[model samples]
Target chain A: MATDAPRRGAAIGWYVLLSALSLIVLFPVWMTIARALSDGSATLFARTPSVLPYSPIQWDAFSRAFTEGGLGRPLLVSGLVTLIIVAAQTATAVGAAYAFAFLEFPFKRIVMVLCAATLLLPIEVTLIANIQTLQEVGLVSPSQGFGEAIGALTLPFLAQAFGIFLIRQGFLGIPKDLRDAAQLDGYSDLGFLRRVAVPVTRPVIGSFVLIAFLSAYNQYVWPRFSVKTNRWDTVQLALRRFGLDNPDQLNLGFAAAIIAALPVLVLLLVFQKQLIRGLTAGAVK
Target chain B: MGKRRNVRQWALAYALLLPSLVVFAVFAYLPLYRLVHFSLYQQSSRLGGGERYVGFGAVWDVLSGERFLQGTWITIKFLIFTVPAGIALGVLLAMAAHRRLKGIKIFQTIFSSTVASSVAVSSVVFLTLVNEQIGLLRNVSWLSLKSPNSALFAAALSSVWQNLGLTFVIVLAALQTVPEELLEAAHLDGYGAVRRFFRVVVPLISPALFFLAIVLVVYGFQAYAQIELITGGGPLRSTETLLYRITKLQKNTDLQVGASMSLGLFGLTFLVALVQFRLLERRVTYGN
Candidate 1:
């Protein structure tokens, strides 16, 4: 009983400490939400930050953000671009990983090395030249149409080496006997990949998909530089313009930021497991 | 027949790899080749003038230039401010939430919630939070938003906060991998909690820590939106990282200088990455 008291006290102390830490961690996000929902006039003049939304929550900021801030178009463009990139990346990665994992071929080592080398050359390193390349390809021009701009946005990201490596790891984990068994059952190479390898590696593929979506959705630099016009701005780029272009409507900007972030947040909540797995994929063994 | 079969298999394998190969060639290898090519020649000052061959001069000028050096220093400073602090905070949060206490999941979720925030979102959140006039931290004297020197720190603060979720998640995962018996044995010994953590837990999770360090360093180097959205690399260009400078050159249509700077940034990143692997990999204790 004497020791129990101290242990209980320690537990309570931990609870308190953790609660405070959580608040600190959550404060920025909560404050953003509060400011987004608060009356613009009150928020502009308020000296102390309110912990919650001001009474009679002003929902007009969201409408203004959606329309006047031009968030609606960006949301569509970002979603379409993210979907295209994710789908293409998954297809390309799965194909490349399938070849790497299950097939024997000449110059495989050199090809693998070349693929891995791309990991070092991030988009930032290749930014200026890539822009030139896209321009040369007529994908990004002064008068580039909508489709060309979307191509510019999604082309460089169509295939990722990390995705290949991750999916290959998954494919490599399938036992040789399983492949042999499928082959003996008269399954063709592509057929075996479709039925056996893919089903077995769904978790890895799912993880890759979630991570790819998150990254594609959150992409800032490429879109910011590549897309010359506001017509094709991704949500991130749009938010930047919205915030910078509308300094007076700070609440509107905040509201748009929240609106932009909501999709990924919901995705994170739903796909938390795969997201964590994909993120920590290379961190662990 | 067997030769034909082998040839067919090779064909299929090559076919499967074609998409990635083409993309890599055009976007990755070709750009790298062009960057070198562009850096070797200087564009004429006239708008439509052709190129002039200037082998290594542009690269040397950019690499040795003041802006490059200053940007490099600022990037290094940004790394210094963000990486270690991010790691320490991650470890702290992970340890706090690693216990078997009730409702710990909620705390873990909260700690990692920032992972949902995109760079732009996180930047805007911090920008609003640290605004000069009506910001939550406006009254806080030490972190003055108007100061040039503290602008980098302010940007770093947003980065650190934004990255906390990823760091916490990764570290918490690492913490869960620590063996119960090992900790118990350390506890059974004369080692106190802090000593035991350092002696036993630290080495055990060194790989994850190393991984986190590399990731955070890369992230710190790649940081643009945070600086752009938060400080705009401003108050006398105090937060202008290497990437930021490259983008500035890009904006100015100085592709030659930008290409050289890009290569320089690449070289710097490669060197830092090499140093990290050399210095840190030796200490990482990978559990069997």
Candidate 2:
């Protein structure tokens, strides 16, 4: 609409800046993929080897890195943990949000304040005591192994304070009339939440779930502290150890990074709109 | 229908809330309880011991150390560097994009995409880009990468760049709240772009800037991955922030010292945040 006359100078300035930033941002990612394709030609000291895949691409690096990095076990573990967290957080946040937004309750304001206050407590602060508590409960018994340890790491993060708050903000936008009518139609509170609030706020829920999942998957500190065995190292830990500690295995490290990053990249591509909306939603509030 | 329905509705509400309450109580509130209790005692659970009641002595011990004081100083320095830099860059980049230009969508996406970067990934990318041997920045430094001047500056520079996206998005959203008519009027009043920006646009969007500053301050304190990956808080602990020192101390002897230092660091962060929020509240205009 504003294109009647091209603002050539302003447009050029914007273009140059954007292109340069993109190049800076894209270079590392390009290097990873290119290295993976080039039989590790673009490893740590390899420089920008080649943008294109070699004629006989060494696809073995992917499989090698996957198993060699002990990624298969953790991938399954992280995937399962991520799913449980997403489902649990989404269900919990939506339920809590519905209660806060629509239902009248005693101490609603107090509960809301409690929810908001939880946002400021850093997990690292409580992590030591939390680990001790988990040990007492047998959830973190070393004998139970890495898979169970992954679950322990995910449990504390299962009910996110910010997710509940974000969902509450979204649910507040739903007019009282729809909810009131739904209640009058002989539906229970839970039923009304399911039929009315959930359907209305599906997009926000989807976005929050994705955000929560990605956040859980990308978690570094919690897993690093909680997971006792390297066998249970999540993708992020594997990437860090490989990329930093073992420089000689640079090609494999690059391959590992590419593998680790693939899921996030795919998630971004798939839910670009919702991801942007959910992230910016915090600032908008 | 009315009376019976109201009772059922309230019951259902409690039922819906039960799951989250259970999880939070077990995981969050329980851990919080343990933390408070642990802070009061002299012994860690790892070492089964005859318990000694120290009361608030641990908190006292935490705040009384030179290490803790140095940590507070470094953390404050980091906050000072990152928060203002993040907000300013965010605003500048947003302004640069605010002009009615072709391909604005591309710019917005490119800038905002960094919001998705985990601290770990951001650190890796930055470390690789600035590695003394292979980093893109290796060749640009007049001083060798090993030089304290280049090393510390480069580490800070990478963190600032990585965070620019988050700051940009917040400021850009704030910028959208500024009315176009006000800008047009300022232009008609013969104010140039810079004058109009400082006079009209800035005041309107100061709230977002303030919020972003607080967020960045919290992030700066929580800066672990960046320091760990790029410099390992090293080249002689010159780049070591409070967290890095705490972690290192923990790995070495003196878990008590490390825990105490962490608590002290947390206390300082809380105090500064409270003070900043109060001061910034005066300048930030939230609404029309």
Query: What does fnat come to for each candidate?
Result: 0.73, 0.30
Best-performing candidate as measured by TM-score: 1
Show model 2 residue runs off by greater than 4 Å.
Answer: A1-6, A27-64, A141-147, A243-248, B1-10, B44-46, B139-153, B245-259
DockQ result, candidate 1: 0.75
Clashing pairs in 1: none
Question: After TM-score superposition, what is the CA distance of residue A31 in candidate 1 from its true location, in Å?
Answer: 1.5
Clashes of each: 0, 0
> What TM-score would every model get versus the actual structure?
0.96, 0.87
Tens digits of per-residue lDDT for model 2, A167-222 = 99888888989877886898766677778878888888888877887788877766
Q: In terms of lDDT, which candidate is strongest?
A: 1
Clash list (residue pairs), candidate 2: none
Per-residue accuracy of model 1 over B157-257 as CA lDDT, tens digit each: 88999899999999989988888998898888878999999999999989999999999999988999988888888878888999998988763248778
Candidate 2: docking tier: acceptable
- Cα RMSD over interface residues, candidate 1: 1.3
CAPRI band for model 1: medium
- List DockQ for all candidates: 0.75, 0.39
lDDT per residue (tens digit) for residues A186-213 in model 1? 9999999899999999999999999999
